[model samples]
Target: MIRVYRIPFSTNVERVALAAAHKGVEIEWVDVDPADRSPVREVSGQDLVPVLVADEEVVFDSPRVLAWLDERHPDPPLWPRDVARRAEARVFVEWFNRVWKGRPNEMEAELRKDEPDEARLQALGRQMVAWLDLFEELLDGRDYLLGDFGVADVVAFPFLKYGRLGLPEGDDELFHRILVHWQPIGEGHERLAAWVERVDALPRA
Candidate 1:
């Protein structure tokens, strides 16, 4: 059996869990306290949850874990079958993790200020809309990223959950507040709105 150490409400941790579930891979989840990551450190030499321990091998990082799972359990693969599409999916995931994922932090900082910068906030809003527009273009005719439910969707879904479509159940209020500045899903992003609805119904581990 596979064992995973994770903390609740962590999008990164949820990424691994969702990918595992989509691949029909069963996992033994060990929830860890955010204040105390010693349990996670003991196995991975780092205080990071979403660490996967399997076959006496341990792996950290959500993207790496997803790759490891795909390599170990190829059935219902988490990546697209086509080599080119698979490469594109990896690029999308990398860009999302490195770039767009950090935008929320910047937005939240401005939002939490006593006197928020309206002009800067608007700029951030425009940037977010631009990013969403890219996703809208990507989903031109496809249901999920790359035309199938794969790792790209698994990674992007958790962050996109806090969109301005009003809070879904269990969404972080602060995150929703920060992310809501972008264009609403219902307004111009019809495909993304539908994609969110479609992916929200998928299974998670």
Candidate 2:
């Protein structure tokens, strides 16, 4: 069986877990202490959570693990079958990771200042809403981001779910404020909220 070293609640780790679950791929989940990463280093020479040790092949990084799962399992594909759609999925993941995902944290930091920049906060909030609007538009007349639940859903869910469902109890207060600022996944954006539920309802293998 494959073993995954991870900090269980982490979004990245959750991505791998969701992908594995979607594929019904059995995994030995080795929960790791975030404070001490010696085990991860020993296995994959990195401090990142979600290092997958499989068949003597060590794969770290959430995206790589996702790819490995798809390659090894193949059944119920995690990516779109059409070539163009596959490219679109990858592009969405890239933009989410590199561009959209961290805006909340940035907003939180700005909020912490003694004199928060109202103009800047408003700007960031608008930018955040624009992305949410894009997500809402993308979901128009479709079940998932790309017609079916696949890579884009797997990558986007862990973060977007919070906008609608709100964070779990004991989640960071600052992050809670951040989500409140955007409120991207609720009544106004019914499609995105529904999509979150769809992904949330998937079997947790």
Candidate 3:
């Protein structure tokens, strides 16, 4: 059986769980708190959730986990088969991980309650809006980033959740718009939304 070390609320862990479900791959979910980092370090030599231990092979990193799962079970493909489209999907996933994950300011207000600086919060809001604007441009008329709900969508969903929860406390209007935009995109697709719901409903381990 595949064992996955994860945290329920983590988007990164959620993506792996969702992909495993889509592939009809059963996983032994191991719940871990981000704060209690020692368990992970003891097992994998690094503190990270969404660690996949299968058949004595340890796979860390969400993207690598997805790729390993795909290779092991190729049906209901998470990545595009066409070369160009596959490259596009990979690019989006990379950008989503790198660029989208850098919006620490979105969570700054909550993280720093003792010294709430208005200027810093406002700057974070503006920066978040700029990033959302970029998403708007990228998602102009597409259902998914690469015209299909693939790995990119799974990777992007968690960050979107963070934006919805974090940014609203700082800038309500911007958060509302982003949430609205994302709702339809996520809801419009049957498989994608169903996958999300399945993961959301799963019994945490």
Which regions in candidate 1 have their CA more than 4 angstroms from the true location? 109-119, 164-176, 180-183
Against the unseen true structure, what C-alpha lDDT does each candidate score?
Answer: 0.83, 0.84, 0.66
Give the alpha carbon lDDT tens digit for every residue of 30-135 in model 1: 9898889989999999997789999889999989999999999998988888989888988998899888876777878888999989898788778887888888
Q: Encode model 2's per-residue lDDT on 86-204: one tens digit a residue.
A: 99998998898888867877788898899999898888888888788888999999999988888898888887887877778666667665765576667678898888898889875
Residue 103 of model 1 has an lDDT of 71
Best by lDDT: 2
| Candidate 3 weakest ten by summed lDDT | 179-188
Alpha-carbon TM-score of each model against the true structure: 0.87, 0.88, 0.71
Instruction: State which candidate has the highest TM-score.
Output: 2
For candidate 2, the C-alpha RMSD (Å) to the true structure equals 2.3
Question: TM-score of predicted model 2?
Answer: 0.88
Per-residue error (Å), model 1, residue 57: 1.6
Which rank order by TM-score, best down to worst?
2, 1, 3
In terms of TM-score, how similar is model 3 to the real structure?
0.71
Which is superior by lDDT, 1 or 3? 1
Residue 129 lDDT, candidate 2, scale 0-100: 80
